[model samples]
Target: MKRYLFLLVVGLLFFNFGNSQAYYFPERNSNWATKVEASNSFNQIALEEAVRFAKDNEYSGSRDLRIAILKGFEREPFHKILGPTKKRGGPAGMILKNGYLVTSWGDTKRVDMTFSVTKSFLSTMAGLAEDQGLIKDIDDRVGDYIWDGTFDGEHNSKITWEHLLQQNSAWSGELWGGKDWADRPPREGGVHDWKFERPKEPGTVMEYNDVRVNVLAYSLTHVWRKPMPIVLKEHIMDKIGASTTWRWHGYNHAWTEIDGIKMKSVTGGGHSGAGLFISAEDMARFGMLFLNDGKWKEDQLISKEWIQKAIKPSKPNVNYGYMWWLNKKGNRHWEGLSENIYYAAGFGGNFIVIDQENDLVVVTRWLEPNKIAEFMGLVNDAID
Candidate 1:
């Protein structure tokens, strides 16, 4: 009886201990430790803790977050693949934009919603349209096309493409839904009832609005006379050859907001938060393409001059550009970031940070939500 009791106690202890340890999300051969140099600053313990937290919540680290680490090591090598055979974590594959350090993180095959990172991709598309004379200028008024009654008035009609890019349009419509994504109308009289009337003036203030961007997408489609997705494929994705796949959620049916309000049903246009989907490494590849003056493997995907213009701070906001946000602090807009470090940030801490001086692109995704800035701070400290 004592022996049986002893075994029972031991088993209980083991169970408790096992419960105490955070669950770890497993990836095949994810022993990146063998690849990282001793001199590198990444805290392996911290990363492990993060992974465990992700797993404990069934957060889908790769499914939701497309994070990977790479370096030029002699002993260990990297792998590449596209989407998953099963419910995989990340993308199908990635491309080597530039050598050992230039390689992208592929193989894990995680694919999830990449939210606002879509805007950065869209900015490149706009740049291409500009370069090809498909669009006149960023400063052009949105009222010229899409005779939507929204921008038809005198004050509202002055809203420019640049205003939309910078989030300076000041068009006060519905912003974000907080609770149930399915209950509210997407827009008023759109496909549903959640339609936007009008806000204040153009380029007068800065308020983050996703529906405004949808309008930009519509404008692009109207001018190009082709689906925005096709334009993105031909101009940006294919040009870079990044070996990744993505889809736009569509203007009317992509998402159900946390507030139960669906934006697609309202405006018949997809908003910023629900439109984009891509892999973390692919995102890094895209960021690097920008970092290298919009060149990819000896091909100039975007004009260097245009890339510079895109990154530069805007007149009104000082921290946002055409679908791109600038990292400015000391100068203005409270960006509170170093000049060299810029990021493509998305909902739930999805980020692709580009360090121009360091020649590095750090991609991270956290299913945990709201902890991205903290993790990014840690990554920043490690790399610096």
Candidate 2:
């Protein structure tokens, strides 16, 4: 009886292992397969509830994104839209389970501006650089690559690739007509106070400053010796079978010469303007790549090691990891969800959530920011 029971247990283990290896990946320009009627893995009513919640709780910001950009960041001094802004569409998103489309709302093909979610893409560029040996190590000083005065000062010189990736660089500088002190100054402080304040040690405090992020972008442009968008397309997007509609934009004045050719340095976020403009479906594809440990079909577009490092929490911010937001127990934690969940989030409710534990990828656009946790929780509750 004991031998028979052990044989049954081994058989079950092999079956589960074989099933886990059967994740589907969509091809370029191909329709993503749906499991709505075919699969009984999800609670259909609960899944519908998640979709309804996302659609009903659309972002309150103006659809005319130019007006939204200016008004949303009105507190910043001299804030101007220096890059292209497009009017966004209604609430649009998709939920994928085991790489199959489970449910989606709005026009999934409509290309919309994804604000700071661009940071995660920028972070991926750094990972690619490291994977290709362009960046020897994340701990290496940024000043070593670009000797331009950007990282000259004592405080800025101490900044490393990891520090910038973690948003704890605290590098003080102005770029593309945006001042470091003026980007998003504290509510209680004036320009004089912010400008004169000493910067914290690199890798110490996490501050969400766009100027610093742009600096990282500028430095990476030098490291890769090409426009970031081109690198992204050739290295990641193309490999993942992303659509042609996606674009990565930089500020009008962020152009610089590299290898005797001028290339625009893209912003990590859409603070003043311009970042990644992509369709919900493309974003889902990118999330799917990350969900599969940076692999798409037979290709490992990005190293598994890089993806692991990208999602691991930094010491300075447990909820942040190389521009990706963690669902860890912090201020941004989504209650009742898996702690292993991580996502790319942008302003005005753009999100690409990767729930690896459940083999789920959720892309949400124009959702009310505060309602994300609840919406995600509802989606989580749908799994059988």
Candidate 3:
């Protein structure tokens, strides 16, 4: 009887100790402290190799980013992109272990355009809308909320918030000078092939179209009844204690009237220039929130169910989520990376990789696409 009682006490103690060692927020203003006090079959050498890889393999994409974006979209040259972009950029990133900054490189502090990584943040805003009941049901017809002719046609009328989130809505027409078909035309097709292609049933096929993502942005603006940046700042960024240096932007022509006031409808990506411009450290903090299943410290910034929903593969594209890229079966999938590993990816190889299995988060900028798997594999090998 005494032994049984002692065993019960021991089990309780172990449970409490295990719970105490869970995740925590990193210090806001300080450089991350290295916990690699000892070296060996541990991550010290792996960290060194990873740093070297980032420094050597800079993005091999187009040197002139603005031109690349414009040509990709087949759009006219505009005076300026909607968001701020630096004339220069270099390899930058941060490694987080159990919600603490483990290491970082380059100008992680410099605010640079994160491009399509903005989509993940936009996805977060949509998750927020769902959490606050601003959007009743993602599966329901968004036409109920947005009465504009945007989703009015027979094929389009069937679109739901889910379809838009998945980029399968094939939402017709134009927004802010960008056309649905022209945003990112397939390399295999001519202009006529793209323009004349009939819209597929929602959720039947997936296409990566920035204009449709922008439609989600515009619709979300209506649902929240505020500029997306304002909503993002108030609810997500500030709540997580993000630095004041970050900026979110929308196109100059995207502004229009809503409820007797004008608001700018933001883009889902920086293809035309304007999305989330932020420091790597802040990006890590944001990734940590998702790593902790959408919790910030003690406040539940977003629900676990929503995180599950966001990370789960969309029917049309197993590699894509609400906006996050899954390291599963898509072209970007890495054979060595865990299936559960997912990321917020942008142009020029910018990535915020979440490895929940390892309790690690890695944010990188200007990382070449071809070398991603190689880099990720090296990091995995570091795990002792």
Number of the top lDDT candidate: 2
- How well is each residue in 1-384 modelled by candidate 2, as lDDT tens digits? 999999999888556433644567899999989754324668989989999999999999899999988999999888899998899999999988778888889999999999999999999999999999999998999999989899998888898999999999988878898888888889997878988999899999888989889999999999999999999999999888899999999999889998799999998989788899999999999998988888888788899999999889999899999999999999888888999999999999999999878888999999999999999999888887
lDDT of 1 by residue, 68-141 (tens): 21111111211111122212353222211121232223342356666667777767767887888876787788
Query: Residue 266 CA error for candidate 2 (Å)?
Result: 0.9
TM-score of 2: 0.95
Query: Clashing residue pairs, candidate 3?
Result: 83-274
Could you list the CA RMSD of all candidates, in the order they appear?
Answer: 17.6, 3.0, 3.7
Clashing pairs in 2: none
Candidate 3 accuracy as lDDT: 0.81
TM-score, candidate number 3:
0.90
- What do the candidate models score in CA lDDT, each in turn? 0.52, 0.90, 0.81
Q: Which regions of candidate 2 deviate over 4 angstroms?
A: 1-18, 36-38
Clashes of each: 30, 0, 1
- TM-score order, best first, reads 2, 3, 1
Candidates by lDDT, descending order: 2, 3, 1
